[model samples]
Every structure is written in structure tokens, then in C-alpha cells.
Target: MAEPDWDRMMQAAQAGDADSYRRLLGEVGAWLRRYYHRRLPPAMVDDAVQDTLLAVHEKRHTYDPARPFGAWLGAIARYKWIDRLRAMKSHPSVELDENLPVPGHEEAVSSAVSLERLLAELKPAQADVIRLVKLQGFSIMEASHRTGQTMSLVKVNIHRGLARLSAMIRSRNDAG
Candidate 1:
């Protein structure tokens, strides 16, 4: 039998020919193993190689057939390696609020309006600092940089603003 043409095998595989896919995989599997081993742990190399091949199979439609098949395959393998590395480095045990209940939309809206009214009662500087550091999700350092204010001043303004707003909110709730 004539030696198998690799380019022909790749082309056939791209066209969804099962035999050509198997042949190509068998031929390239060793190279893929070496490729992955250079980047991943020995224990992870086989799984990474398998995942890369599977991703290549799944995303074959996105491949430009005009491009060199090896280049496209290499790109897929690189991305899969990155994904594996990210997964390995990630801490799965996140510190989440298990006891926190989901707030309803109405409750969220009312709380937002109350906060807005409270913030509006403060002086512009106090309101701006509080909104930047608290309401708008900015860190204290970020709020300081954005407002061109000192960190100590920003902290003081936010503390006093929040205290005043809290007292006002409590008084309003009592009167109602």
C-alpha cells in the first residue's frame, strides 16, 4: 500500500470522514503528546492532548481550510494549554455568602431610592466621595485617585456621610 498522505488525511478529516479522522489522530497523537509534555505536567499531558484534539474536532467548522492545518491545530493546542493552566491555578473553593438571600426587584429599587435621597442630603464633596467609594463600587485608592482627594479625607467624608445618612434613614423609618 502507498504511504498515507498527511495533507490528504487532514483534508479528509476536515470533511468529516471518520476513517481519515482516525488515521490523522493516530499519526499526530505522538506529536501532540510531545507538544503537550513540553508545556504541561507528565500526569496531565495525555488529558491535555485528548482535550486539544477534541476541541479541534468540535471547532473544525471555524477553521479556514485555506490555512495550514498544522498552524490551526497548534493554535488550538496552545489555547487548550492556557485553559488547562488556568483551571489548575484556580481556587475552586470560593468564599461565598451561603446565608445571603436574593433580594426582590421591588426591595432593591426601594433601597436604591432611599440611598439616593440620603446621598442627596450630603454636601457635594461628601456625596461624591461616598458615591465613588461606596455606591459606585470603587476602592478607596481608586476613589482617591479619581477625585484627586487624599485617602484620609476620602475616608473621613465617606464615614461622616454614611453616619449622617444612616441617622436620617433611621429617623425617617421611625416617623413613618
Candidate 2:
């Protein structure tokens, strides 16, 4: 049998032909997995492939029938791969604090004041590095690159700043 045309397959799939969709998915899945495998770890390839397929399925209606199906599929796969990389690098974890009660109005105001004081103790550069790397979730390399500072400088500033903050917090707690 002759090789199936991708545009035709996509059109047929879009028209609700189950077999065409299945064939398109099977053909694209392997290519997508290989694409993701090159950009990500082996363990993430399958997940990237699945996510790409689901995205393609969900967004199929938006696909311009005039465009090549592989290109559209590839674009979706690339987006999903990048998203997975970002997510894996900084995966959000939910911490359930059952023991910690929500702060009231007065507590919130006091906590804000305390944080301001704590941050104010550090020099501007140190404070900026701490805020970028610790508070803003940038990696040291990212902080350095974003701030135009050397990685070593960023690391030193963060370390010293954190030590100073710890000492200040401890002293305040002890005094209180």
C-alpha cells in the first residue's frame, strides 16, 4: 500500500474518523517521543509524548487544514516538551500545614513588619540577590545570568545574606 498523506489523515481525523486519528497518533507518537528524548531525560519521554498527543487531540479543531499536519504536531510537541522541562526543573510542591493556623489581621501586619526589618538589615546587593534567588525561585545560575553577576558572586552573596538573616532572626527570638 502507498504511504498515507499526512494532511489527508489529519482531515479525516478532524472529520471524526477514528482509524485515521489512531493512525496519525501512532505515526506522530514515535516521532514526538524521539524529539522529546533528545531534549529531556529518558524517563520523561513517554510523558512528553502523551502530553503532546493529548494537546493535539484537544487542539485539533484549531489546526489549519491548509498546513502540514506534521508541522502542527511538531509545534505542539515542542511546546509540551518545553513545558515539561520547566515543570520538572521547578516542580511545585504543595505543603499542607495542618498545624499552622491562618494569621489574623494583626498577625499579618506584624509579620509584614518583621519581614521588612529582616530584609532591611542586609546590604542592597545582598538583599537583592536573596530576593531573586530565594524569594523569587531563580536558580543561582539564573540569578547570576539575570543580574549580570558572576555565579560565584551570587552564591557568596546568598550564603552570607542567609547567615546574617539567620543570626538576626535568632537574636530577635532570643531577646523576645
Candidate achieving the largest TM-score: 2
Positional deviation of 170 in candidate 1, in angstroms?
54
Whole-model alpha-carbon lDDT for candidate 1: 0.62
TM-scores, all candidates, are 0.47, 0.50
lDDT (C-alpha, whole model) for all candidates: 0.62, 0.63
Question: Runs in model 2 with CA error above 4 Å?
Answer: 1-4, 92-176
- What lDDT tens digits, residue by residue, belong to model 2 across residues 54-145? 88899999889886666666566656654653453243211222322343334334433554566688987777776676545577788888
The residue-by-residue lDDT of candidate 1 on 47-122, one tens digit each, is 8888877887788777675666666666667666656544532322112223223533343345456556656899
Candidate 2: TM-score?
0.50
RMSD of each: 22.0, 19.0
| Candidate 1 regions with alpha-carbon error over 4 angstroms | 1-4, 91-176
True-vs-predicted CA distance for residue 176, candidate 1, Å: 72
Best by lDDT: 2
Minimal lDDT window, size 10, model 2: 91-100
